[model samples]
Target: MSSRQRLFTLMYRVGFAPWDGHPLPQALRDLVEGSAALPAGTALDLGCGTGDSSIYLAKHGWTVTGVDFVAKPLDRARAKAATARVVVEFERADVTRLSTEAVGSNFDLIVDSGCLHGMSAEDRDAYVREVAAVAAPQARLLIVAFIPGSSFGVPGIEPDEVKQRFARDWTLLSSGDETAMNHNGKNPARQYLFQRAV
Candidate 1:
């Protein structure tokens, strides 16, 4: 089995995955809902865990496609969408090798919630190129992950790195750091948002 498949299988066996959080992250919901002038178009949710954001986006009228490397999580994501009565296409594919054709052409909006952090440097570079290639002009890309000063295993990617990776094809619209405190007030996290250039 592929590494991604193994990862998913392990996650399912452990009964927990980064993308399978309950209640979802408020930061993401707020980001999507508050973005005034959000065009109704195709949206891609990369590494969509349990399909929370995917289902939410679909409910808001965006045709959503969620991609994940793990089949176990994709299964859960699809079930979540079905239960929510939201139509979301969930596919198991490695983001590093993701093709535009697999996503049905370019996407108008792409959201990556905690996927980039897990990638090695080489994979991250490939991911950046793949994303740039598939993102439509002026597409909005929202990313949420642990930043510097966090205990997350993945090293934090600086804003400069983000720009270096995407600026050739994307523009940094706005970015900020948020301390995402959960119910227990522990396991704080960080997030970032950007927009593709026209």
Candidate 2:
């Protein structure tokens, strides 16, 4: 296992991953419920800790797949899906190196609640490539990440980076405020909407 995977595993095993229990942010829910971009189709939830977001999508008639690297959280995610009576395919996957073999060939919608910010610049580029590879035509990418901030050690991804990385293939639809909290208070989140080029 990669050291990054080990770190996340330890975080989950020792109860340091507090984001595991957060409910779907209201803004995200509103966007998903109101936007035409996300219809009832296949959904991929990256960093789907405990499968809450996956379960949410499955319950809404979307065939959902939740991917995380840690087995402990994936087990919990599976249990949650079982209890919720929703079928969310839970897989152990590294976000930095996602492939069609690991996550399937095409997904209609992809949601990254907190993973993209956590990735390094190189990993983020890999992530963009993987997203481009797997996204279906007219697919939508919804990202909730912390904008650059004073929170030391937290992944503070810049909006310009996201734009520059995805400029070729994705058209930014909009960006707005969010209340989702990371390790820090309030998180100062920015929810971005993107559509794959036709």
Candidate 3:
């Protein structure tokens, strides 16, 4: 099975997910609320595990499309959206092979929370290209991932790696190391953010 399928199976077997945290990331909320008053035109949440970020964006007035390859997580995401009474379009698809036709159209903002870290180098390249293709010229991209100092099996991606992968098509908007207390309450991970070049 593909890595995406493996993730779905794992989540299906486990009754609860490790990453489903209450409340949106403070950093992301601050950025989205502070950037401008205009509602975002279109937004894509790639690898949107359980749709926390997607739901948050929708609540904040951005029309959101969440894509993940996992079925169980998508179900949970749909339920969460229904509970929150927000409208979101959720799809089951692999990010590595994502196409605009599949996503329906381009977007003005894209968020990937720890999605790219699990991908191999080649897949990461392709993922970036695909995302670029679906983003507008001035699109804002928010990415959150584990950095190298984190524990093993945590998909620890280095800052330099992010720079090398995204610099060609995106400009660094605001990036810094920040920790998030996981649902387990012991582990924390780093996050980074960027914006598509104008």
Candidate 4:
């Protein structure tokens, strides 16, 4: 396994996953709740540790697939989804090397919370291409990532990088600071919403 994968596996084994169990981001919630909520559709949760967001989407009538690189989390996620009585397909796979044949495709919605920011530049490029390949035309994408230099000892991504990377395949819809995320409340985060270009 890659060092990053090993690190996450160890974290999950020790129950030190701070990224898990948090409430879904407001931007994500808006996609499924309230009057402005979107119609139920196929969704993909990248780096879906423990399947909270995947279960949320499934509970709202979506067909959800949750992917994580570590096997430990996939086991936990499957158990959680069973207890929640929501049918979410949990898979052990690297987001950077995702394949349509493995996870299926044409997802109408995609969510990445605390995932993309942790990847190397080459992995991020591969991730963008892999995601775009599976997204339906005009698919809505919500990404929550720590702002650059604010991820404590971990890597973070700048909003400019987010836009620049997705410029060709996605249209930037909106973005804002989400201060409640990250290891400490002091480090600022961001949520970017995009639509897949037709």
Candidate 5:
């Protein structure tokens, strides 16, 4: 396994996942709820640790599938879904190696909260291809990631990079600042919205 994969595995094993279990990001909530909500449809949550976002989508009337590389988080996610009285398919799979057989296809919406920013550049390229392979025409995608060279002091992605990478297959819909994530006060983040080109 890759070092990053091993780190994630170890984090989950020790219950040190600081990214799991929080209110859904406003950008995601706005897309699926309230006046401008998109219609209920098949949705995929990439790197769906503990499934909070996936459960939120399910409760909002979308058929949801949550994918995670770690096994322990998937267990918690399934239990959380059960407790919430929602059915969400939780799959243990790598986002860069997604396939129709691994997690189905033609998802109307795909969410990647704090996942893409952590990957190496090569993995990000694979991520873009894999996401498009499963997205339906005009499918909406929401990505919440730390902004590159921001106050977070961690490696992050830039908006231009996101747009440039998916330019051929997806169109930029919106890009805006996201609130601080975890205990990193004033951490600058950005949420990018895109739609698969028809």
Candidate 6:
């Protein structure tokens, strides 16, 4: 297993996951409602914790792939998808290095749920590049992340950082505060909608 995968495996083994795995976030649930309008092509869920988002997409008739670095969550994700009666291919993958070889390419939609903010600058840029690699031109991306200032120091990312990183290849369509349930007494966040530039 990769080092990052080992670390996250330890985190899960030690019962230290900081995010909720029970209910689907409001932002995600809302997104699913529009699945009809989305391309029936592939949809990817980055850092798909326990497979909820992937299952939702599969249920809506989209081909879904859920990727995460940790094996533990990916295992749970598979189980949950089975329980939900939806087929979601869960792969243990590092988003920063996600490749066409592993998950295929030209995805029609991508969703990032609290994944981008915690990455290092290099990995964040790498994530954007990988997204571009897998995404079809004009594909849609939705990001929900812990906005800067919701908490103090380390692992938080500002809106500008995201915009600047994706600016070269993506056009920001909208952004706003998100109401996804926060684990620690109202962890403030925002969501951004973008379309890949032609």
Ranking by TM-score: 4, 5, 2, 6, 3, 1
How accurate locally is residue 155 in candidate 5, as Cα lDDT from 0 to 100?
74
The models' CA-based lDDT, in order, is 0.74, 0.81, 0.77, 0.88, 0.88, 0.80
Q: Which wins on TM-score, candidate 2 or candidate 6? A: 2
Which window of ten consecutive residues has the lowest lDDT sum in model 4?
178-187
**In candidate 6, which residue ranges exceed 4 Å CA deviation?**
1-4, 34-39, 149-154, 182-187
Cα lDDT for residue 117, candidate 1: 67
Leading candidate by TM-score: 4
Off by over 4 Å in 3: 35-38, 179-188
Q: What TM-score does structure 4 among the candidates reach?
A: 0.93
Report the C-alpha lDDT of model 3 over 128-197, residue by residue, as the tens digit.
8888888888888878776665654556678888878889989987776554535365444555667788
TM-score, every prediction = 0.85, 0.91, 0.87, 0.93, 0.92, 0.88
In candidate 1, position 45 carries an lDDT of 88
Clashing pairs in 5: none
Worst 10-residue stretch by lDDT in candidate 1? 179-188
TM-score (C-alpha) between model 1 and the true structure: 0.85
Q: Model 2, clash count? A: 0
Task: Flag the better candidate by TM-score, 3 or 6.
Answer: 6
Q: How well does model 4 score by local distance difference test?
A: 0.88
Superposed Cα deviation of residue 186, candidate 1 (Å): 7.7
* Cand. 3 Cα-lDDT: 0.77
- Candidate 1: give the clashing pairs: 19-49
